[model samples]
Every structure is written in C-alpha cells, then in structure tokens.
Target: MIFKNISKSKLTLAFISIVITFFVWQQGLRDSLNRPSVTFDISQKEQEIAELSLQSIPVNLKKIFIINDPVDQINKSLSDVSFEELTERNKLIRIITSELNDPKIYKNISKDFENKNFKFLIDEIEKKSNNNSYKPSPDTFDLFKGDRFLYHLLSRKFDFDDSALITKSFSSKMFLKILAIRLIPLFTILIGSILALKILWTTIALKKFGWKEIKYLDLELIDMVLLIAGGFVVLGEVVSPLFSISLVELFSRNISNELSQSLKIFFGYLFMAIPPLGIVYYQIKSLNGEFNFKKDYLQFNFLPIKYAIIQGIKGWLTIVPFVLLISLIMNSLIDNQNGSNPLLEIVLNNNNYLSFFLLFLTTTLLAPLFEEIIFRGILLPTLSRNFGVISGIIISAFIFALAHLSLGEMPPLFVLGIGLGITRIASGSLFSSVIMHSLWNGLTFLNLFLLRT
Candidate 1:
C-alpha cells in the first residue's frame, strides 16, 4: 500500500479534492432537484400506446396489454386544484375529460395556448358540449397530422368518417414497437423478481451468495479518493468538458443543432474519460515498473468471454426488480419528481438518425465502459481492501449514485450501483460489471427508442 510512504502534501491534496467534490456535487444535486423530469413525457407516450392499441390492435391483445380505460385513468390523474396549470399534462387531462363534459375542465380552458390547433380543438369541444352541433372543419384532422396518435384520439370524439380507415391503417411497424414497449419491461421485471427471490433464498439458507474480496490494486484509501474525486471529477468532468465543448463548438458551426448536440456529448465523453484513465494507467505503471498490461492491472479476465457475458446478464436480471421497485416507490411518494437526466429528454425528442446513433453510442457503450472502470474496477476493490467487502460495496455504490448529481434518481441509482458492485466482486471480473452496466443502459435506450412513437 502507498500509505507507508504517503507524503503530507498528497494527503492534504486528497482532503481538499474530496471537500471540493462534496460541495460542488451537493450544489449540483440541489440544482438537479429543480430540473424538469421526463416522467411526464414517458407517461404521455405510454398513454398514447394504450390509446393506439385500443383503436388498432386485436381486442385480445389489447386486453392483455391495457387493463383499464386509459382516458378514465387520465381523468383520475388530474388534480382537482391544479386544473388551471397550463402544463402539457394538464392540457391532455382536460382534452380527455372534455368528452365527458366536465364543467371544471371547461372552466380551465380560458388560459391562452400557443398551439392554434389545440386551441381550435378546445373550441370545438366547448361548442359540442353546449349542443351547438358546430362541426369541426375537414382541415381539423390535417391540423393534427404531425401527431397521428392524438389525431386518432380526437377522431372518435368528432365521429370522423375516416376513423375506421385510419384505425386499420396501423402499420405492422407500429405494432411491433408498441409490443416491445409493453412486453419488455413486463418480462424483465417478472424474470428479475424470480431470480431475486432465488438469490435471496440461497443467501439465507445455502450461504452461497456473497461478495468475495480480492485486492486488485496496491493503493491506499486516499489514492482511491484522489483518483475519483480529483482525477475523475475535477480533471475529467470539469476541466475536460471545457476543452471538449470548445472543440465541438468551433468545428460544429455548420451542423444541425441536434447533430451538434450529439457530437458534443459523444466527444465530450471521450475527452472526459481520457484524464482519469490516463491517471489510472500511470498509477499502474508506477506500481509495477515492468507490468503486464492485462494481468497486472484491472483484471478484465475476458479469456472466458461467455462466462463474463452470462454473469453480466444474470446480474442485470437480478437487479432490475430492486431498482424498479425503488423507482416506483419514489414516483408514488413524490409528485412530479425532478432531476431526470437531460439526456433522456434529448433522446426522446431527437428525430435525426445520425443524432440518435451518436447518442446511442454515448449512452449504451461509452458510459458503461468508463463508469465501470472508475467505480467498479478501481474504486470498489480498493475500498473493499480498506473497509471490508460489504461496507466497501455500500460506500462505493453511494458515491457512484452521488456522482450522478441527480437527487430524485439517487435511490434507484444507488440500488443499481449496489448491483454493479456486487456483480464486480462476486464474478471477480471487471468485464462482467461493464457488461451489466451496458445492458442496463442499453435497455433504457431501447425503451426510449420504442417510445418515440
């Protein structure tokens, strides 16, 4: 360990770095609490899926996927006192409830709306409620052409003659997307619950489920702290972004805004990874002057590639239920919980294929690789050596979650980090944890892609 020979200056530097990281990260977390969440967008897409399935898919399949009247549920979701809020969710709730001639909903439509088409729809709904028989113009359908799903919802209300044709026009492509959206989470959670229960049983009865500690690095706790707090946070996140953003801005002046944003994220991540990883490389080199790259540092252990993949898959499957359960609890407890990563909204709203592809590479590939290396490959093993395996796992996971600077998402992310930590130690392979992190992110990206409809 470097503890015996550690200089006072190095320890002081580590202390200062950790304090700076804490304060800055705390401020970031506080700021994140006020940031808008993507939950509303996700809810809207799920509701659209339910509404579309009702109109397009077979009754049996629809029944299997959608359990209740989606519009009725939307109506129930509306706050009695917050009807005057001009949010997108409020507008949707009013539109859905207007079919039932809700007097309260009509009263709230006095607020001005920027969308002329939506304003016209509200006007038509009002006229219909008053028994005016004021028919919507033929161009009314064309007005909502940009949002085909919303067009379908209003078609039934207006009794459009082409409603049947439109319902029948549901493409096989859309059906598959909807199917994946509905089935993937359901199946993942189901399998995860079973696997989690089995793992619990083994832990309690057989005592065969636990992390096995291994010292992967000959570094002290201060070294680990400095690597993460100083190298990763200060250099990688703060300093690297300054350069990466400038580089991207200088060269991307002629590109589309979406493409520019995507490029910034991709290259920014690559740049950010460089300093911390470089520090790790130098630290390894310093420790073992004539070291073998593969064996002497960060036991990737990919000789048994299939084993790593399977262990990763198992870790992912086992972790889903716990993480999702935390998410569900948080959502129920906090209305409109914020601090959703801005990248989620970007991915959801992005229409350009190139932009989307770049984003996919950033999230599903680069993020997993870099994060696993820092948190699992380096931090976890060192902490385990200092504090024992279980404390090491919890503390590392807490730091991992805190590093995201998203307070609303912290609980679930902490749960996810725990799963990654356990997987790293139990599998005895950093490659397994990387694969697990990649799978977790890849599934989230896939869901977002499917929800774009």
Candidate 2:
C-alpha cells in the first residue's frame, strides 16, 4: 500500500506540476504578446518621404528604403499614378535580369547626369562602365517604388548614411536598424546560461545556490537506464491510448464521438514509438554488466523551478535555446486544452479540459522521467558496459527520438535526447538526464499552457 500510495503521489505531483506551470506560462505569454507599446517607425518613414517629394529636385528616397515603401514618381513634381499602386505588376521583377540590356541613359540631367527628363537620366546612368555592368531600367518611376527590385536608380550622390568609404556599403542608419532586430537572437544566449548551470550541477551542487546545500546528483546510470525505461514507457505511452481507443471502438454498440481525436493521436503516438525500441535493443547488446535492476530504477528530486532558475544559471553554464524555441513552436501548436482528443468529447469536452490538463502533466513530467530513465539510464549503461560510450549514446538518442508520436516534433526531440544523454554521461548521474528531460517537457508545456496565440 505504501509503495502504491507513493507511486500515486508522485504521479499526482507530476500532474499538478504541469497544471501550475501551464498557468504561469500562459500569463507570461499574454503579457509579452499583448503588451501595448508605442512605435512610430511608420510615421517616421512617411515624414521622410514627404520631405523628399516636396523638394522641386528629385531627392533620393533610397536611404529610407529600408523601412519605407518605394515611390513611383516620374519627376520632382506631381503625384500622378505610380506603378507601385497598380495591382497586377509582373514586369517589375525583370529589371534584375531581362532589363539588363538597357543602356545607361541618365546623363547631365541633375548632377553628374543633370538630365531634366527621366529618359535622359536613364541614358547617362546606363552607360557602359569598366565593371561591365550599368543597365538603365526602362521602366520610368521604377525608383523608390513598392517593387522588390531596384525600384529607383542608385545614386552615387545619395551618400552612405555612415561609413560610405570603410565598409564600402551598408549605411550607418540602416546598419543600426538591422543590428537592433538581430539582437533578438540574444534571447537564446540567456537560455544558454541556464544550460551552463545544469552542467555545473551535473558536476557540483550549486554552492552559490539556495542555502548552498551539498547536493551531489549521481549520473552514472542515467543514460543506460533511460535507454531502456524511456523506450518501454514511450511504447506504453503510445500503446495504452491505442488499446483504449480500439477497445472503445470494439464496443461498437454505441460509438462515442471521442474516437475522432484518437485516430490522429494514434499517429502522433506512433511517431514517438518506433524510435525508442531500437535504442533499448542496442543498449542491451552493448552493456555486459551483471544487470543492476534496483540501481537502474530512476529517481530524482522534483525541481522547484524557482531553485533551478537561481542555481542553474549561477555556475559556469549556458541556457539551451533549442528546447525553448521548439517549445515555442509546440506551444503554438497546442493550448491549455484546445487541441485535445475526443475522449474529452465523450465527457462533453469538460473531460477534454481535464484530459488536456492531464496530457500536459503526462508529457511534461511523467514522460520525461520514465523515458529518460529507460533510454539514457538503462539502455545507455547496458551498451556502455559492452560496446562503449559513443555507440551507446547515439543508439539511445536515436531510439528516444523515434519513440515520439508527433513526427514533426521528432527531429528537435532527437537533438534534445542526444544533449540529455551527453549530460548524463558527463555527470555520471541519472539526475542530470532527468533534469534535462524535465526541462524539455516543462518548456513544451509552458509553451502550450503559458504562451498561446
């Protein structure tokens, strides 16, 4: 009874953990996506265009082209019909290829080509240069237009916004805009910091962490045990639902609508199932240890993420972005219970909400723990005892991935499995693998429950 109760308690905790994590995660998403922010970029671009157009001479609008739409003006005056305003515009793309034959025409219209007419400007700019390139775009008002091609002619006088001579190209103002956007990738680096902490804990208990308690997590059995147990759990996870659905269907006297989600879900589970079996077989063949069954039974402390956050990033560590980003996409694919199976349908979908909740718990907590134990803990150890480390890790990782039901989610999961296995091997403890496994699952649940569209 105690053992059964403990098992039930653990499962209950796992389930509750998913629910709580999801709520917090969704709140974070709502805050991030729906926050009201003031941005004046569009208005700024409009103002710049207005200034250029008002000028009697044709002012260069290309400098602001990075953010602003192109103009199809014929001369310095008149806001007549522009080519960009047209709906069916196919000839615009040809300028880069077919239009290359046109001769340099923009001559003595303004500055170097002080041509008063558009044709004259084209004639001058189109003149053959030593570079063997210089084609006049035959289309008038092509400059600074909405088209993807050079909507307008490139002017030497436009002048580089910043270092026109040093970098040879890329205006300073434009460069800054690009730099700002690219900085978003920095989010991943923050994730890397967390991963780094995990590595450290895999080795030493976070001394600078919560109360600095000596928490040495043994990792020796993680990979091999995980390899076997993870595989078996994955099979069970996939198979149980299938059997449930089939049995329900077999009771054809009255078929419930819930069967709809079951069929596709079966595919989802199938996607996960095939991969883990191979991993276990490979591991069993590799390791020759007098099978240590009791030691291989996986166990790990439930990480209070609060503690994980502080201790995980305090040491020499980097947060992993792969799982986070994947979680982001996965979260987008699901919601608290939006994309759930129809068994929830049989229970008027209130059960759906419950099932959805349960699904989160299972995927995030239960799946990760047992799966990691079977694949990384058991199988990997078995393989290493016989074949060696490299082969064991690879085989187990592959099996871990193949065991997933969602085929689309497989590639990323495989990569994650490998990382988990590697960490387990390095730390020589199952705890490290469990942490990684839990982290991956938690992130996915967070994405789904916490951050929804």
Candidate 3:
C-alpha cells in the first residue's frame, strides 16, 4: 500500500486547496453581490436636445434644402459646436438649416418632403415672408403623428440614454472585472467540491477494497472497432435525424416548434441510450456470466458510497482546466478561420423552455450514462488489459474525442476522455466515471442556461 500512502498525502493537499478555493470564492461573491446599483434621471428636454444635436437630419430634408453635398461642412460644424454656442436656439437652428435658399437645391424640394423639422421650419418661413409665396405642405405633419421621439418629448418622461449606459457598462476594464468576479468564484467552488470528494474516497478505498479487489476487463481489437463503429452509427446517423421534420411528424398531428424540438431531442436520447445499453449487456454476458453488480458489472466497487463520491469529483476536476483551455484555443482558431462550431451554434440559438429542458436531460443524464458505458466501462478496461494503462487511456480518450466529429470540440473532449479514463482506472468502477461525466455535462448545461438567461 505504498500507493495508498501517497494517495493519503495527495488527499491532504487536495483538502487544503479546497479550503483556500472556497474562502476566496466566498469573498469574491460577497463583494460582487453587494455592489451598489446604478440610476439615471435624464429629462425629456435633455434627451430631445441630445438626439437632435447628435443625429443627422433626414435625407428628405437634405434634398429639400439643396444641401445634398454638405457632408464635410455638417461634420465640421457638429465637431466644433460648444455647449455655450448650442444654448443659442436661433444660432443652432441656422447652422442645421443652412443652404436651403439656393435655386438648384430649391428645385429638388418637392411637396413630398418627409422630415419632422420641415413643417415647423416652413411655417416659420411663411410667417416671415412678405409676399406669401411659400406655404407649408398639408401632409408634412402626418409623418410625425405616431413617431416614438415625438411621443417621448410630448410625454416629458425621464429616461436614461441606452447607448451611453451600455457603452459605460461594457468598457473593457469593467467587463474584465465583472468576468473575473463571476468566473473565479464559480470555478473555485466547483474544483473545491471535486477535491473534497477525492479526499473522502481515498480514506474509504483504503479501508474497504485494499487495492487488490478492483476488476479489469480484457478487450480485443475487434471489440474496440465494433464499439467505435456502433457508437458513430447510432449517435451520428440514427440519432441525428431525430430533429428532422419527418420524425417530428410521427410524434403528433399538431406540433408546435417547442413540441417538435422536444420530441426530437427525446427520441434522440432514446436512440443514443438503447443501443449502448445493449452493447454493455453483451459485454457483461461475455464475461462468463460472472456479475458483481457493484464491482464487475456496474464498476462501483472502488469504495463505499461515501468514498466513491471522491472518484467522481476527481474525474471532473481533472478535465475542467483542460476543457477550458482547449475551448479558448479553439474559439480563437475558429475566429481566425471565420467559422463557427455548429453544435454550439444550435445549443446557443435554441432557447425554447421545453427544448432547453429536453436538451439538458439528454446531455446531462442520458449522454453521460450511455457514453460512459461504451467508453469507460467497456472500452477503457478492455484497452488497458491489451495495452499498457497509459497507452490504453490515451487511445480510448482519442476515440472518445473523435466520436463527436467536431474539430473545434475534439481537444476538450479528448481531455475529458483522459479524465474519465483515469477515473475508471483509479476507482476501479465505471459508475464513478459516469457520475463524473454527468456532473461535467450538468455544469456545461448550467453555464449555457445562465448565459442565455
């Protein structure tokens, strides 16, 4: 039990890490949650003035005023405007309404002028005209009847400028601060939970199994090929069409988008789970009908329930950092390539409540169970028996990652596969890997859920 003694020392270190992680997380969370709220009291007049000063006049107004080529002049005047100068309403009006009297430009001004300011300015011109030659168009005021800006101005309601607020909230430094506040605490807690479980399992495994009773499977090359092929056929071709229109039609006569999506995912999970479970049963039967449900069949015999939880935690913690790093690298590469991960796109875009629930259930529960049975339960031990432990784990992990058929996702999936492989070997139970897989998927689902919300 030299290995067990080493495990005990590792367990103590993991426990200390967990304690420190939690302390830091708690403090960060407290600070973030207790930050003061922001409030704004922008008045209607201020908003209206800001909008008029900032926004360019309508194209129709430019055509009418014969200012079709004044882009430079207008930009220069806007840039040079001071608060003191802007306070003079008459001067501000003159600056905005320049070049309205040229004959070439006036010829372009038709009765169809649609600018909001046109009617008001025309009325003023008519009042000042001694010859009474110009008249305001009857239809000019019709365009502003239900306008949002006019309604806001008339109502005199106080509101914050949304663009300004958004810009302020997402300034680079502020954004990074917020991200650190939220992410660090969350990751710390997750890792702490995993380490705590590992410590508990080390103590329990030492007492119960004494490291000798752990079972291993002997898998042939043919078994590996068949398992891999069967998995691809089921998950890729068979389960993929669960979202097809024809499949949705089979579920109900009147299928809404949500219902259709839910049924698709539901059937998808069923297809994924049944075939793998059958494979697992066949594998168990091939073992001379010797079934130790906990150790041999289910792979849950490394320790009692109390210590077994540690294996699950260790598996997840092992994969998380690798997954995160791979994800970051993949995202950067994808950005450079100007491409997207289709599976991620689908998960992100599909936000229906029932659809989300179905997706969550499939990924977190069904996927973990079936995938673990195939990869960890059947493949890992089999490969280990044929090859050395390290080679077997690496090979199995590679296959597991490749099964997803996503270049962007492969690295992280491989990392996850390695973690699960290690868990299966260390704990001597497939169930432990399954728990770890489930927790990892559950966390991924939760992260997506929070982001969408």
Provide the TM-score for each candidate, comma-separated. 0.87, 0.37, 0.54
Off by over 4 Å in 2: 1-188, 193-242, 247-319, 322-352, 405-410, 450-453
CA RMSD for every model?
3.4, 19.3, 18.5
Worst 10 contiguous positions by lDDT, candidate 2: 86-95
Per-residue CA lDDT of candidate 2, range 180-288, in tens? 3334345545757676657568557655422221122222343333433443443444344566556545654353343344333433444444545465445444443
Q: How far is candidate 1 from the true structure (C-alpha RMSD, Å)?
A: 3.4
lDDT of 1 by residue, 110-167 (tens): 3566666666677677777777465676566686766667676666677676554355
Quote the positional error of residue 237 for candidate 3 in Å.
3.4
Candidate 1 regions exceeding 4 Å error are: 75-131, 140-143, 161-175, 204-215, 290-296
Which candidate leads the pack in TM-score? 1
Provide the lDDT at 56 for model 3: 39
Candidate 3 local lDDT, 108-207, one digit each (tens): 3323345536544344443423333544443433443343333222222112233332243333333343344346536755775676476569768777
**TM-score-sorted candidate list, best first:** 1, 3, 2
Better of 1 and 2 by lDDT: 1
